[model samples]
Target: MNINIKKYLIITLLIFLIVNCTGNDSTYSVEVTNPLDSERIDEFVIINFDQLKITQAQQVNNLTVKNGETFIPSQLTDTDNDGTIDGVAVVLNFKPSESILLEINLNSPEKSKDDFIKRTYAEIAIKKSAEFKDGKYIGGNYENINNVKVPYNHIDHDNLFKYEGPGWESDKVGYRFYLDWRNAVDIFGKKTTDMVLQNVGVQALDQISEASYHSMSDWGADILKVGNSLGIGSVGMLDKGKVIMVSKTDSITCTVAENGIIKSDIRTRYYGWEVGNKKYNIQTDFSITAGSRLTFTEIQIDNEADNILTGIVKHENANLIKQESSIENDWSYLATFGEQTLFNDNLGMVIFYKNSELLEITEDEYSYIIVLKARNQKASYYFGAAWEKEKNGITGEKDFVSYLNETIQKLNNPIKLSYK
Candidate 1:
């Protein structure tokens, strides 16, 4: 074979081998169907690729349901599998509907108890100090420590001393008297007595007398009360607006309104005022079952007052004729009335119309009457009037008189006329 022809033949053979290997490594498809309805089989079902050891799988091209319709995968398959293709599920159950709330049982753990005691002691100590000072220790000035306003007196000094010791001591003291002079003999007493005195001097000294301390043991009960107020280690059911801490477990059911306001059976305890609106009724050993039901009420307006005419102005025939000619000449007429009318939070309803076609009005005359009737009897004290003009400057005195009478009559009792 020629050299060039041999090279071409070798390249063709390599291409053929590559194509054959690629075909052999191609992926295959597996049809998946819901057992409940084999006819409604889906093309793709998700599976962990790593766990299933599937490097590749045939792409899902279409999905179909028997007697239903065959749809393109992009067209028919709900992306989220929620009934709607827009990812909104209209009828599919996809996630859990209920939720669980976990509450910590503070009394069950020993560590919680110890933490509670420590927290309680610290809190009470601070509170006691506050109560001791009232409003005197609010600022940096300590002159009002005991409300005496002494200069340079420290407010926290008493508290510090309570923990430490008193500052000064009394100088008064008494000594024991010896009765027998021979027994009380000094330096010449005995060598044994001297040894006893030396031994006593070496013993531990009584430091209690040296320290001027005040014992808090007398206020132990008060301190404990303060601790209990802090809700240290107690466990209780949150009921109503309070926390109910009980000794035994009891089943309690409460209904919560839709407004999220709780009206439970628990009562307020000590320090309730300090807790403010965040108070929880601690019920001990009690479990709540059901909450309160929410109720909503809507209000509707029933009867409304109707507008009554306080006064009216009638146009004379001569004046009507003059006004008609003036209106035709591009002039307008005005009506005036003055009276104080009570509106009382009501909207004013007004309607204007004319008897002649030459007289133009902006709104539908019948609709305005209907609105005025709906007003019931709400009176408007303000004065109002209607304007009239011809389409082409045609002055008709008779027509003008008729229009004026009609408009005035309409103003007096526009609401009485019914459109329906």
Candidate 2:
């Protein structure tokens, strides 16, 4: 045989072997399903690529799930601020029990975006400037409020430090706390695409004390009146029916984790409180997924006290209602609804608790509070607000209670995921 012909035959045989191997290769399979029918789902699902030894960016980038939907490997980071990227977090919409196929092509190009998943996010910001002063109206010199009372009373138009307090927001609602010893939490009703926290924080306060302070539109306004009450899920201790509040949060830290073009999740840590003889700590994690009417608040407090209390601020026009717990679900909610919005529209505030963990429900002249027996030196709960002005917002008391019930159901029956 001629040398050149033998060489060509060897090359052709190698090509044929490679094609056969590629054709027989098995595609990976992963099953992702939502418990609800056609509802958007946002939860942290752990993807253990470690077992498969797929740690590098290129390997993760080539991963796809159902319908050629690619993953966001470029924006991957240590979601928990840990040293390594432990797992993949996803936000997607799926029909009930929708099975998805996961495949990988190490040689394929990386995917730069994951936009098919509709995700709404939450934000938190704290901007502190000593240049604004510490007094109630000290910052008025720097930023002119023009003598207009900010729509939200907790905001001090004069003291920019008061404006420096921590501000949190979701697509459905927004909230801030007075860091200047008042320890009061206030609410901001939202309307537009709420992706900006720093802007919303300054704008909400600025608009209230500006020329249009009195003007109210559907887009948003400082809606909830906090006063000396707990506001929306603010924490205090109920010592023999007397509400005892900490003077202030001794140390505060905030974080914005998992921020993407379409989604965000934020956390605020208000720690080091000296209440009575015991020192306490509070951590709040808020998640606002797309199309959600309420922000999911996971509150954990550290203290030796047997019980911890959280509540809704009482208002003259706001009617307080308690939903009885069912034996099957073992969860109940205390809610308020009525024309309590700063704009005089319907607003709702709710706090959900487990029946087995609840010690009692009590209210004084200030708030409608729930007392939960602290287990393992901590208690967990969810609280949020809804405004009638927002699209598809809670329209009435019934709707508000219904939302709470549905949320409880979701918490009880979370979306289950498994691997094949």
Candidate 3:
């Protein structure tokens, strides 16, 4: 079933341009301009057929895209989730200052579609029913779910969620946030690139038992030890040097949107959240892309506050890395790297965003908080982690820092995109 997850946030600058039409025909060409001087890979672009004036014969639903002579697999998406299909999203790789041509065939003969390589996944699963009168679900068949209306009497450790909450991941890493009062985030360090969450926690649906993901497995293990701290970008507000987590919310509703061949996203609304003397409602969106480790967040609240913060857990063994962007109103990064995972191995966690949105950086015994100023009750940022065990993972501090810097630069400079 297709669900409307809201429009994909343009984390990367999306520019659609139509370059040419070879006479009156079903085939047309688009030029994608990579304005950057550095090689960019795994770039994603979406093509709207309607916008391109490309029409298929009545009842035709197939399309094929060619990058020169090479046939590339395209992912069909209902961009607006309006039931009717609108377009296809494709991945690209660009050399510095590259302009790649894409040929779109609106009425291409239907052929058996070759499966695209899946690099991302998202899931929110829970036991189908309560097993006890006290609202405890001990054990039962678990069902993957979406748009869950959180129970009013919900409390932490209820076994109401798989992996404790909604989980989203790319090939490089995995992340999840607690659905209960703590609302903290955590990371799952992957040892393989295959989509593995489905098999990772299938056996521990019982409340009396927990998912075996905590123990080392072939796919990977739950690496972060999130205590009371802002596990990894958990939403909160600063009150007297302490982070007021999303604890006193009257209600919460979660909806899963896209589960990716390209990207995956989930949206949630927290109602009547009480922080200190102020009460507010918040809407959040978290998404990750194929081949990327970053999980980006977009937040909108009913009330504006200057001290809205998100943070990463503290580790005595990790060295803190902070960078101030030289470009004003551009991006900066906050990161930590060291032997901080539950396995006591090398792990790196980072958050990067506009420096103008940052208010302060502070810490307690449990976390290092990046307090942000919310204007118009809105804020956004990206957080991610890397483990040395993952296939082709970032292992050294210098390499990790280079990754962060390159990511920030990419965010600062967007390419020109268009289709004909």
Best by TM-score: 3
Q: What does candidate 2's lDDT look like per residue over 1-420, in tens digits?
A: 999999999999999998777534424445655565545354434445553355555344333333357553222334343335544545455556565544434333444345443335434333233233343432232332211111232234434432445455555666666544566667777776544344443433433555231245445766776777888877677775678764555565556655544334455566676666677786655555445545545556776767777888988898887888777776678888899977788888888788888888888888888888777766667777888876567788888877777777766665665555
Residue 74 miss distance in model 2 (angstroms) = 12
Off by over 4 Å in 3: 1-29, 46-64, 76-88, 104-114, 133-135, 205-210, 418-420
Show pairs that collide, candidate 3: 15-417, 16-417, 16-418, 17-418, 17-419, 138-207
**lDDT by residue for model 3 (82-109), tens:** 3456777777888999999988776576
Local distance difference test values of all predictions, in order: 0.19, 0.59, 0.79
What TM-score, to 2 decimals, does candidate 3 have?
0.84
What TM-score does each of the candidates earn?
0.15, 0.71, 0.84
Candidate 1 Cα RMSD after full superposition onto the native fold (Å): 39.2
Best by lDDT: 3
Q: Tell me how many clashing residue pairs each candidate has.
A: 30, 4, 6
How are the candidates ranked when ordered by lDDT, highest leading? 3, 2, 1
